[model samples]
Target: MPVYTHGGDIRTAQAAYGGEVLDFSANLNPLGMPDPVRQAAAQADCAPYPDPLCRDLRRAIAAHDGVGAEQVVCGNGAADLIFRLVFALKPKKALVTAPTFSEYEEALTCVGCEVTRYTLDQDRNFDLDEGFVDTIGPDVDLVFLCTPNNPTGRLIDQDLLESVVKRCGAVGAVLVVDECFLPLATGGPGLAPWLASHPNLVLLRAFTKSYAMAGLRLGYCLTANQDLRERLGKFAQPWSVSTPAQAAGVAALTCCPHWAAEGRGFVEGVRPGLAAGLTAAGCTVIPGQANYLLFRLPGVADLKERLLTRGVLIRSCANYHGLGPDWYRVCVKGEAENRRLLAALREVL
Candidate 1:
């Protein structure tokens, strides 16, 4: 059988460097999984199968966001939902920001969709410009915008996004916004507010990031367009979300305030500490509201191997569509962990 690998495969990294390694490559919540959510999984019944449609979890999320349950679609994870959305829509041509999440392109390609890239200028700190609306028009069927976008950790202007959505809607394009990292931003809401106005808009969210439940594989999509949700539901398999995942997701939604607040606080508190450390070590840390920070080492590629040898795993951005060798991204971790990573990186650099 042929084998394929995705970036941030820890087992592959572990094989290369034997030992428990701190994972900064993946932009996950560094505060770790919330205790209440973990506890909920333990009490959930595993004997019978989970709700095929994730009824309870959907209700919880809908109530939490003040949306109708019918407007919500739960999936195994955000990635699964993204894939289903792409498959259901079956866009012939899609537009995505370069250096964004890899899964978007992979999923689009699986549906025979051709994708176009809008590269973010490194000098501009990879911020999305109003030009995005210009690139997405009648020719495009899907438009993906990642706020506080991956790797770059830059956000698109909210008004600009709204305008882009309007343009996409006018041209019958589906506007998909990935707010997976939105919780990390200081002033932004999770794009839930705009769902009513833009019926063509689809907001992708997950308990995996802010709620620290990545392993639980809990994710959902919110849209005012009932038919899109129905199409996604039809394409999704029965019980795509497991029993424990449903329980954990409900717990996450109910207990979201505590966990989200704590994770945000941890990232806020550690941002300066990590930035200072990186700056001291002669790297330029880009400013952002996300839990992860992007830094350009004076010469990061030169030190990648040495950092790996030190049992420290970091995301080297050479593989990212628009990013170059000097770029790297790391999730904001706990205090001690960040300190340890900074120490290792200092030595490596």
Candidate 2:
């Protein structure tokens, strides 16, 4: 069986199942891409070279994020930014949480940085706590955190986040908070308010999940430290963000203010029932506030494979750092998709 790596695995599913696949792996905007974003992408005159600096898009992102344009750095995606930051900082030692996104470890390892995992207790629902703050010391040079964390989707508490940020600042460790899923995350007042005070903080965000433009590959990071921003420029190649993606990003922020909010509200409305349905289907669903739900089915070792046979592709969280083969994460999609997924589970179970 092909390994279920990331979401939007329709082609892989088709090759294996030879049938239509309802993808619940990628946790994107349930409403799909906004029309304005599509239009902006379509209208992008790609004939000329892209603005290597991505001036206009950065400005728009700045306005939306309430940061100076100089503080913003655009990239193909958050993963791109991750690698770039890793290369730029070249930190000797770093700290990351377990059961979170894998890119941080991948990026850090690529640069030969020693990574220490501060494991989140899965029994406590994989939510970060105060003790994680202690992991940030003078010895640790970089830290990665995710709000509405991947695979598990539980949010970081604001106070806990502050402690982490403050602790990082005290030790001069650069804290990279990946808030890519924050817009869809309900009740998440993101840590943007701390950027002004803490120069060591980097808020990594992306338009892929929130704007439903995964194909466009639009992502950026916010930081107050001019040296860090300038260092990113030194490491990143020119035109790292393509023209159409740039246009789409600008449109996502400036042209469509409520687009993210719409997706957030829609996910908020649908996620509870989906969690309930998963629980009813004999899975221990981790109640999350983001656009996806993470659950565990104890007896179904090959649940992802079985679902693929039914033309349903849900993320197998087996590969996530602190998770196991029994765990899975599925996006909270629209009604028809959700219904088909539940029906497939009913049969496969």
TM-score, candidate number 1:
0.95
Cα misplacement distance, residue 189 of candidate 1 (Å) = 1.3
Q: What is the lDDT of candidate 2?
A: 0.90
Residue pairs that clash (backbone atoms under 3 angstroms), model 2: none
Worst 10 residues of 1 by lDDT: 1-10
**TM-score per candidate, in order?**
0.95, 0.97
Residue-wise C-alpha lDDT for candidate 1, range 1-349, written one tens digit per residue: 5443333567766888987777887777777777888999889999998999788888998988778888898898999999999989999999999889888998999988999999987778888888878998798999888888887777888788878888988999999899888876655766788788889999998888887777788888899998898899888988899999999988887875567766777788888889888889888888877888888886558555677788888887777788778878888888898998999987776
Distance (Å) between predicted and true CA of 13, model 1? 2.8
Number of backbone collisions per candidate:
0, 0
Q: Output the lDDT of residue 332, model 2.
A: 92
lDDT of every predicted structure (CA atoms): 0.84, 0.90
